[model samples]
Target chain A: MIQLNLHKTLSSTGGKMALDLDLTIEKGHFVTLFGESGAGKTSTLRMLSGLLKPDSGMITVGGTTWFDSRSNIDLKPQQRKVGYVFQDYALFPNMNVRQNLEYALQKNQDNSIIRELLEFAELEELQHRKPETLSGGQKQRVALSRALVQRPEILILDEPLSALDLKMRIKLQEYLLQVHKKYKLTTILVSHDIGEIVKLSDSVFEIQNGRVIKNGTAADFFGLNKTSAKFRFSGEILKIQREDVIYIISVLIGNDIIRVVSDPKEAALLRIGDQVLVASKAFNPIIQKL
Target chain B: MSIVCVEVDNGEELMSVVIDSPESAPYLKKGKKVNVLFKEMEVAVTTQKELNISIENRISGVVASVEMGLLLSRLILETNIGEVIAIISTKSLKQMELVERIEVVIMVKLNEIILAP
Candidate 1:
């Protein structure tokens, strides 16, 4: 498990915030820190990885104490086996892609693993390409591969896809999703994009004004489903279609068709045009009633 | 049986609701009246706050140019409202229909505005 309970402040000219956070992410779970700009998502990530020292609190990752202010235990960044990927695919300008991955691995580890990571990250063709030569998406892939090459227990990604274009962001998001599934990594991502958080996160922590206001499953937070006390629009069901075991129904609201997923058995009870209600809540993504 | 506009943000055209319920559910056989409820009911104050702030109600502009950068996306939206530039994220660009002379919706939250002394 990765546990962090720390308070830190950033005192830059334009940015200043006192962040007090206490979060525990289960092993192999993807926890996304979501908020607006200056919400302290990046600061929290930096504190966890020992990149920034917290004012006070305990942070233990994978049973190792990364920072414990009371005990005065603060491990160095390199001492913690953490893969940190910044928004800018910070590949060394001096080294090629192969060398980048090579540097990530330990001196005693096999070279074949680097080749495998290159293949998995789909950078096999651009092994010799420098950071400047590769496209934005390609550079992101290389950065992700480089981080994973060391097989770190915890992966800390700070807006990894935020730098890319719209199309590139989606592509890299899917790629990262696949990588997480394959490795079951305990990943922490900081992003302002709600769609990205919805697509990639299992759990979402809503940070506003340097504090976590809400914490819930991604589905609940996005309003995809799971009930909450928020403004909800309930529409009438238009049609129901059967797709294998699932019954998909469309609810009509002012020419808009909202689709809801339900069990086939319950769907069978309703006629071809039975009246069903679709509930969509405010502050959560639109969800069709089950 | 009626849906009324409760709050008007951009010139009464773009707004939210205080709907009593639709006259009828068009597609469904069974329909019932929905009691419109305010999402924020715990507020102490009953009166609404209206402040006189210079807001860009509308903007009429061309794409002018699309500056796609690492952090921010600046869209020079030229409209009859005004040739105002808006900064949005790249992820939000997918949802935007940026065309020449397109009327875009610009929402200004009251909390974001700093009250001058």
Candidate 2:
């Protein structure tokens, strides 16, 4: 479990922002901090990783006290076993993929972890390739693997996929999930993209002005059923039949064809191929259990 | 009931809809000219060719644009009927592989249809 009650004062050329936050995250939970730029999302991550010291308050992860301002107990960055991935990937241009992973190892550590990470990230084929020769996606994989070489208890990713294209971003999301599950690492991601938050996070904390304003599961924020009392579903228009002035429109909704009655004037506006929404607030929609 | 004229791009006759007043149904006889309206939230979008639900309003159109947000994506489609907008999850957008010009189906519940004469 991770427990934090941190207070910090930040001053940039823009102005001063106070960051006062209290949060407790369960172990192995994929949590995301979502906010706009300069909202202190990255500051929170840096504080957790011991790269930034809090002005006041405590931060404890898995019973290991990383910070306590009152007692002046602050652990060094290297002392905190955290795996961090930055947006630029920060891979060494001079080193090959295998060398990069090996360099992150502690003194007297075995090289077996390097081989394991290379296989886990599917970079064994390109292990000898330098960072300059690798693609953007490949460099990110190396960075991720290098971070994991330490077997960190906490994994922090600050917009790691922001630089990649949509296709590569999707692929890396899967990889991140796999590594988080396999290693049982407590992962914290900073993202502005709602889609990425929903796709990966178990819970999301919405930050505004350097403070956490809302917290909930992805479903709570985006579930369709939560939006209304009326019945809703997506389907396609299949056929339109005219009987006198009333038009019957056939809609295919998941293998079921439903016919709706409409007036000729209203029906005239709809084509056979037009995507339309069917809704009614008058009656209670029946729910059948299969 | 509120009546509004909808202009279609294909030069079809102007479409009118009566909205919010269901009591106007009795006066809406055959061949009667009336306007139709439905709540925006009542609309849903899907890429599936077939669905098993009992919804009545189903229309297909080509995707015109998709505005992706952190949680919801606004999709606009141009169909023969008119331009329809849908707000769905970004996850669904990706899973459906919905992009500009892709054909999709829009569904709405029957009772949610509001008419104004």
Candidate 3:
């Protein structure tokens, strides 16, 4: 299990506050950190990665003690087996897609692993393409491939989908799930979009004013009341289309075609011509993707 | 005469009201109900302005268009206010909730706004 107890303070455009958090995540778990802008999500990630030292606290990953203010032990980021994917899809502009990923395999030098990552990311054809030439979705796939190339014990992703356009975001989300399953790496995702957290995270940690307010499952995170009417109609699965990272599915219900926020699994079940049911108290069906 | 516009998403449509303020512009409450313009183009008490944490409500719409990976979904509204655009993240078709239209009801917290003369 990954246990994190951290407290830090930083001055930013947003107001400042004391950040105190204590979290325990099981192995192979997908945990998402969600909050509004300046909620300290990025700070938490920075502390874990050793890029920023905490004011005071302890951090342990996979039985390894990374930081401890009391014992005065702090490991450099390079020594920690961590794979980080930034929100902007940080790929090398000077290098092609292939070289960008190859650089990540520093000591291991596993060519076969690189090939596997390329195949999994559906980039076999674009391996030689430069980062600038590839589309946003393609670039994200490359970033994901690079992050996993090292096969780090822990994966850190900060708003990985926020930078992509809707369709690319959805496509990359599916690819991310695949990578998560294939590697089973303990992953931590920081996102401001609530829907993204609901769709991708198994567990969600709500951060506010430099503290974790609540930690619960995806359903709980959305406050799904068992008595609510969300299940009144088992909305039919429709045909799913991928633009880039966003998936748009068309469903036929009575005569209305309602679109809801979704992932690849839901999109795949939808057929171009099919019927689906949707039920909600309020008829405001606006999928706001931030 | 003083005028203020208010937008309300009561379950489905995005309704708007433009009416004369009973109090001075300084005393007008943004979220509180006041007189509003009705269909007859006259002032009515049925309308109200919402000043809260988030000004807009959350709703589901149809994926009308997609360009360069950005998907644009059009929401069918029942109000006179018109359409709104929201970005979504995901690719799973099963969770897509593919009905041509879906409705959502969101809670509104109050806020404060000043109309400039």
Which number leads on DockQ? 2
- For model 3, residues A27-109, the per-residue Cα lDDT tens digits are 99889998877888888888888899999999998898999999999999888878999988889999999899999886856
Considering lDDT, where higher is better, how would the candidates rank from best to worst?
2, 1, 3
Residue A254, model 2: Cα distance from true site in angstroms: 20
Colliding pairs, model 1: A222-A285, B58-B81, B59-B79, B60-B78, B60-B79, B60-B80, B61-B78, B61-B79
Our tally of clashes for model 3 stands at 59
Q: What is the C-alpha lDDT profile of model 2 across A1-290, one tens digit per residue?
A: 99989899988668999999888889999999887788888888899889998999999998988999988899998889899999999999899999999999999888899999999899999999999998899999999999999889899999999899867887899999999999999999998655677778999888877788988886454442232223544445789997533467897654467887664547789888565556544354576799
Query: How high is each candidate's TM-score?
Result: 0.57, 0.60, 0.58
Best by TM-score: 2
DockQ of every predicted complex: 0.01, 0.08, 0.05
Once model 3 is optimally superposed onto the true structure by TM-score, how far is the C-alpha of residue A146 displaced, in angstroms?
A: 0.6
lDDT of 1 at B100: 42
Worst 10 residues of 2 chain A by lDDT: A221-230
Alpha-carbon lDDT, every model: 0.66, 0.77, 0.64
Give the range where candidate 1 chain A is weakest over 10 consecutive residues by summed lDDT. A226-235
**Model 1: per-residue Cα lDDT over A169-228, one tens digit each:** 877888888888887888898876666776788999988766889999976676544332
